[model samples]
Target: MSWQQTTLGEIADIVSGSTPKSSVPRYWDGAVAWATPTDLSRLDGKHLYKTDRTITEAGLNECSARLLPPGSVLFSSRAPIGLVAINTTPMATNQGFKSFVPRPELNADYLYWWLRANRRQLEDLGNGATFKEVSKAIVSRVKFPLPPLTEQRRIAAILDKADAILRKREQALTLADDFLRSVFLEMFGDPGENPMNWDREPLSLQAEVKIGFPFKSAEYVEEGIRLCRGANTMPDRLEWSDTRYWPVSDAARFAEYALVSGDIILALDRPWISSGLKVAEVVQADLPALLVQRVARIRSSVPAEKPFVFQCLRHPSFWSYCNPTETTIPHISPVELKNYPMIKPPRELVAAFGMIAAKQSVLRQKVEQDAKDARQLFQSLSQRAFAGDL
Candidate 1:
């Protein structure tokens, strides 16, 4: 495949976004879709149809915001850059973006993929004293591999199909998660309502909330004991990306933070985002990893019935208590977590729910594996398409 190398400015109009005065009441809560980087981060599909905020006609007229058409490609330029999405409806964004209005020759979806492929280059262009940002000038100067219109559309369609497969697999996993919640509701009733008249107990009565060790920077080693940071704690699973290690010699000193099988870990700081809470379970495979500070490890005081309490902690109301919106980072102290109220059902009933959860866990693992494979294939296709191998 022959590709033409051209700057983004030549094929598309680069527009810098702006914000309206927040103090003005009429400026917001209106019909126009006003977007930010957060909206792109929370996107679940290819096209961004809505946003967290909206602006009125007066606000749009007063600000530098332009009404972007359906095919305009939005690129976040700051606050960890390179979240790319296309607008399905006309929308406007804050100054965090440097969006592109495609011309006759360029396809919006193709440009979205190009921005993602070259995100590192865009980050390299960022400059700032406070937080780094790539200016509109820098964005306009980005050169991309321009394939023929027909070829561009073809590649975009293929990548779209691959992305859809990943989405469907993810949806299956979500449904499996929902099924567990349904089972919980059926067996125990709502933890908040306590309609079943189950006995109430402080979480600390059933489990011990242990904090991680404050390991020094010098204590880090190449490949010794795995160090689990806050980033490793995902919702319902442990994510290994950005994992660190500590020397085995220091393991004894931090032995209290050593994670065991069936231990539940919760992120103590910045735990809440637009997506969900940050909590995970330490499986047998995740052992030999020392828990780092800002992560709290919870273990049942009793030997049996741990899964029963795990589901209680996973309750929506529990996360709400842990993640009440605040001006600073949303956090739940060890004391607050330990003292959390829980509705405990009978042991036999708890065991029954655990049995069903165990079966669902097996199904979830299979779906997750499929999703991972689909993502890997999508990435491979993206690399090949950009490298002119597709």
Candidate 2:
């Protein structure tokens, strides 16, 4: 394969975006589609066709915003740079973008993939006082490895197929989540309506809800006892990649806050995300860790009832009962979570359901593995494609 060394400026016209005046009533919500970095970040696919806001023709003329024709490769430059997408329709963006219009000799889809492959490099290039930003001059002057037009299209095609497989694997994981929720509904019925009417009890009576202590940052050490924070909690699992630690001597003073296996931890602040609640089950690997503030731990009095109680807190009904929308920052109060209505099922029934759930998890493990493999495969191909080995 032959390649040519060229700057982004030699093969593409760099375009900077601008926002319409917000105060002008006539400048808002019209025929022109207007987008921002937030809009690009929300996309699951490479192409963008819609935006949350629009602007009038008069607004477009009044502002620096220019209509980008279909096939333009858009890249966000500020307020978290490196979100890339290809436009399928005419669109304009806010100042948060430094987009590209490739020369006729260049394939737009190829450019989009290049942007995806170099996101980290672009992020590193961003420089600003308030928040990092990549100026138009910086982007235009960046090095670009150019291949033949035929080869560019072929490379894009291969990546598109790999991306499709990666997306399907993601869908499988999502389906696994749905399958678990369905099983919950089948065994217990609608938790909100308590259709079974077995009896209602506050969560506090069924389990112990312990709030995490406010460990002072000044006392933090380089290693030893790990501090489990609200940020560590994820849906159904815990992520300890970014962790803080305390000295071994510090553990003796915070014995009560020490975490153990089977304890369910929930975030007290912004407890829910697009994926679901910020709750996780503590496994043996997470033990010997001390809890941090803005987190709560729940443990059942009867070990047999553990699975049932965990399901109840994660149920859609319980989420609705919390109604996090009432406040500016969505949250769940300890009192509110403890008082969440739970159905009283027989101990034998709960135990039987737990057995079934454990069996189902075996199948979910396969789906999770497949998803991980798909991610690795895509990453490898992306590296090869841009390196001219595809």
Candidate 3:
């Protein structure tokens, strides 16, 4: 079968949205969901359950922002391009979005998947001196290869199944994280309670905590060391791609601060945003890597006890203690981290918690592996489908 290339305008109609006047009380709050690009980052799938802010019917009438029906593909065109989500609810978005309402003959899921696969092409079309943006005319003119409606639906179904499997694994990982947090809270009581009933120990006594080396941005290379930053530390994973690198000399200078077999790296800045800590084990070939200035190195005194500290840092009680006083950034300084109190249980009980954490870690590893496999499978399918080999 031969594939025909067509512009987005031939497949769908592009619509822009506007915000209602803020001064009008009736326009400020209502039942309509008002979305921004920031909201797209948190979604698990095409459907969006809620938004940070909502608007009233009066607001909808006051602005160009009209209610987008279910299945409309929403793309962030300004600030950043190609962040896409299909509207599951009757919603209106900010100016940052350029929504595409697909023609009835075209499948919405197919359009969403196709656009996502061709995101780089859309990004390349962005034109602006100050801020990169995809104008309606530019978006409408970008071409894409399309398959028959049935084949499009089939390809979408395959991709959807793969995505669903990955999402389930992610959900399982989230549950395991919650379980670890619960274990920490149960082991250590509320902060207000006296430390007499529990063991009290300084972090210095429990682990080898070290500050990261300060390497200037000019020292960054294309590829050398796996440099970690505040943004690299995520909830359950460390994003290593698109990372800045360090020179061999600076990497050697920061070698001592390099992550060891059982070190937990915690971001001192913006700790509250992610409860900012990531506990990662150093795998083979990860040596000579250095932590960025915003992060700290935490090595447990005992190898068996490292996971316990990882769990402790994620506890809500820890955040409660850290959030009381505001700093320049939402962070816990090194002094604050060192002085922060912890309700220590008996060593045997701590060991038991570590055992449970270790088990959770194994389960999480399996889930992650499954998710990775699903992603690879989806990528392969996408290539084959687009090439008419599927």
Best by lDDT: 2
Q: What is the lDDT, from 0 to 100, of the residue 237 in candidate 3?
A: 51
Off by over 4 Å in 1: 23-31, 249-253, 301-304, 323-330
- The candidates, ranked best first by lDDT, are 2, 1, 3
Candidate 3 pairs with clashing backbones: none
**Model 1, poorest ten-residue lDDT window?**
321-330
Clash counts for the predictions, in order:
0, 0, 0
**Residue-wise C-alpha lDDT for candidate 1, range 1-390, written one tens digit per residue:** 569999998999998898999999999999999999999998888689999999999999899989899999999999978999999899999999999999999999998887877788888899999999999887777777898999999999988898899899989988998888888888888887889898888888878888887878686888899888888888888888777899887689777888888889888888875556788878877888998888999898654567777777888888866754564766778888988888877778777777787777778778988998998998899999888898
Worst 10 residues of 3 by lDDT: 274-283
lDDT of 1: 0.86
lDDT on C-alpha atoms for all candidate structures: 0.86, 0.87, 0.76
TM-score against native, each model? 0.91, 0.85, 0.87
Give a tens-digit lDDT track for model 2, residues 2-45: 69878888898888899888999999999899989988889999
Question: Which should have the higher TM-score, number 1 or number 2?
Answer: 1
Question: What TM-score would you give candidate 1 relative to the actual structure?
Answer: 0.91
